[model samples]
Target: MREVQPVATAHLRRDETGHRRRVRRLPLVAVGALVAATAVALPQFTPDAKAATTLRGYADGRGVKIGAAVGDGPLTSDSGHTAVLDREFNSVTAENAMKWDALEPTRGSFNWAAADRLVAHASAHNQGVRGHTLAWYAQLPSWLKNGNFSASELNTILKGHIGTKVGRYKGKVYAWDVVNEAFSGDGSMRGSLWPTKLGTGYIANALRWAHAADPAANLKRFSDLGLEVSVTELDVRIPLPASSAQQSADYKPASLNPNE
Candidate 1:
C-alpha cells in the first residue's frame, strides 16, 4: 500500500483573492494520469548489448530524447535521485528553481544558486536543459504583484526579467517554456495580472524578448498536463481540463493566422 501524507489544503484550495477554486484540482489529476500513462507506455527493452542501460540510452539510439523534472535539492545533493537522473535522462527541467518567485524574490535581485546547480549537473551529465519558464502568472513575488507600477514600468520589468534569465542560460538551455498556461478552457486568454495590466500581447512580447535573449534556444509555450506546443511562428491555443479527451476535442491542430 502507498503511504499518503496529509497535504496542506489551504494553499491549494484558495486562490489569490481567497476564493474557493476548483480548477486547480484538474491539473493535479491530469498530472497523475500522465505519470501513470508514461510508466505503462515506456519501452522495456535494451538498446544494445551493454550490461546495463537506461531509457535515455534507448532513446538516444533511436534519435529520440527523454527528460525529467528535477528539483534543486536532489540535483545538488549526493543521492540516488541524482544518480538515477544522470543515468536515465537526456534532459532536465528545474521543478521550481527557475520560477519567478524562486529566481527573483526581490526586484532587481536575482538568485541563481539553485538554478545554476541544476544546469551544471545537466551539463556535467552530458544532458540538455529545458528552462522551465520565463513568464508565468502564478507564483510571482508579492513585490511585483503589488508594486502598483505603471504600464510602462511593468513592461520594462517584464522585459528585464525575461532578458536577464534567458540571457543567462543562453546556449545552455536547448528549449524554454517562454510562456505557460496563458489560456483558459475555452481557448480564451486567462485574466491574470499580466493580461490584466500588460494586455494579451504579453505572450507575444515574452516570446520575442526570449528569442532576443537566446536566438539558439527553442522557445515553446508549455501548457499544463503535457499539452506543450511550439509557438515559434504561430499562436497556439490549449484547452483546459487537461484530460486526453478534452484536449483532443478542444486542441485545434492549426495555428491561428495572426493576420486574420
Candidate 2:
C-alpha cells in the first residue's frame, strides 16, 4: 500500500469495449493465485466540488466495486480517513494487518487483534474484506525465517500456517492473495526460502492447504486450482503539480490478457 502520486488502477473486470479482461504480468505458475470473487482497491480520490457521486457510488452504478488498502492505525484513529473509506469504498484490504508478521509475530503464538479489527470495521461498513496474503517471503516472523529446519519440517510449518490463518476467517474473507511477489520482474522464480528449501512445488502445496482450510472462498476459476488473475498494486507516478491531461497521457493502458 505504498502511496504513489497521480493514478492507480484496481483489478479491471472488463474493458470499456465490454470484453472480459484479466491482468497477469507473469504466467500462472506455482506460487501465485488471484481470486476474482472480490474487488480490489481502486484509486483514492479526493473530494471534489464538482463531483456528482462518491467513488463507490460510481463503481456500483457500473456493477463494480471500489476499495482501498486500509491501514489499522489510520482506519481506527483518523476519523477523516475512516470517513472517506466508509463513504467511498465498498471493499477494504488489510494493508499490513493481515501480513504474516503482523498476524503472527512469534511462533505458535498469533495476535489477531489488528486484523480482526479491520475485518469487523469492514463488516460494519458493509464492505468486503480482502485478506492481504497467506504465503509470502517478506514480513515473515523471526522464528519462521531464522529457524533451521529440514525441508519436510518447513513444509509442515507452511501448511500449518496456511490452514490456521485461512481457517480463522474462512467465510469472512472475500479473497486471499494466497502467495505474493513470488516472481521477479523478469518472470523468473524469485529466490526465497520456499524455493531454496521446499522447492518450487511448495507454491502448489500452499494453495492446496489454503483451499482445504476454506474451500468456500476463492472459488473463481481462471486456471488450475480455481485461481484467477489480477493486476496487483497497479500505480502510476507523474511529476508533481501535473495536469489532468498529463496524467491521462502518462497512464496509458497496457494490452493485457491472462490467456496470453
Candidate 3:
C-alpha cells in the first residue's frame, strides 16, 4: 500500500477579536478523482514517522467538524482506508451508495445493502453520517428515468421515494444535500425529468418531503427561500502545471467567504 502525504487544511473564521486566524490545519490525503466536483481528499496527520495530532483531533480542538466523502468499497475492504477514515474524520458522506439509483434501481425493489453498511460503520465509530442526497438530476434509476409516468404520478413517486429512503435513516443521518445541483452553470434551472414533468416546484416538494421524514436532519442550502445555507465541497482547482502565482490567485475568491 502507498502512504498518503499530509498537507495543511485551513478553516477561516473570525475570532472574538474580529481577526481571521488559522484555527485548524490537517494533513490532506488526495483520495480519488471526481467529475464536476473535485477529488475526494481525506485528511490525516502523519509527519516525521512519529505520532502526532490527527485531523479529527485538530478539528475538534478548534470546534470544527471535518468530514470526507467515503466510498463503500474502501469502508469494507481496505483496512488502511478505514483506519484513516475512523481516525482522521468525524463525519462521512457516501460517495455514491446513497444516490437515487443505488437506493432504488428497479422502481419498487429497494437495495439498502451498500448504504446500510456505510451507516452502520459510522454508527460503530461514533461518527456522524451526512446523508448524501435526497434528490439530484443525475444517477437516476432507469425505471424512473425511462418510465412514462404523468406529472401527478411522478410527483407521487418522488414523494414516496423521499419518504421511504429518508424515513429508513431518520435519526441516523445528521444532514442531507436535499437537492443537488438543481441549477445550471449559467444560473438557469437545469432540464431534468422532475422539472419537465412535475415543474420546478419539485425542489421545494422534495425538501418538504425529506423534512417530514426527518425533521431533525438539516436539509440546508436554500437561503433564497428563507432556508439556511451551507457550503460543501470546498476546493480550488487550477489547470495542470500551473504556476504558483496562478494557483494563489485562484484561491482568493474562496477566501472572501469565511464559511468557505
* Per-model TM against the reference: 0.66, 0.72, 0.68
Ranking by TM-score: 2, 3, 1
Per-residue lDDT of 152-190 in model 3, one digit per residue for the tens? 999999899888987897767756666666665445777
Q: How far is candidate 2 from the true structure (C-alpha RMSD, Å)?
A: 12.1
Name the candidate that leads on TM-score.
2
Tell me how candidate 2 scores on lDDT. Answer: 0.66
Span of 10 residues, lowest total lDDT, candidate 2 = 12-21
Stretches off by above 4 angstroms in model 1 are 1-48, 51-53, 217-260
Tens digits of per-residue lDDT for model 2, 62-171:
54545677666777677887887887777777767777787788888898988999988887777777667777767787888899889999999899988998888877
Score candidate 3 by TM-score against the native: 0.68
lDDT of 1: 0.61
Cα lDDT, model 3, residue 243: 88
Which wins on lDDT, candidate 2 or candidate 3?
Answer: 2
Question: Which lDDT tens digits does candidate 1 get at residues 115-221?
Answer: 99988887777776667676676878889999999888999999999899878876677666666667664557778888899997787788788777766543332
Residue 137 in candidate 1, Cα distance off native in Å? 0.9
Point out where model 3 deviates above 4 Å. Answer: 1-52, 217-229, 235-260
Best prediction by lDDT: 2
Local distance difference test scores for all models: 0.61, 0.66, 0.62
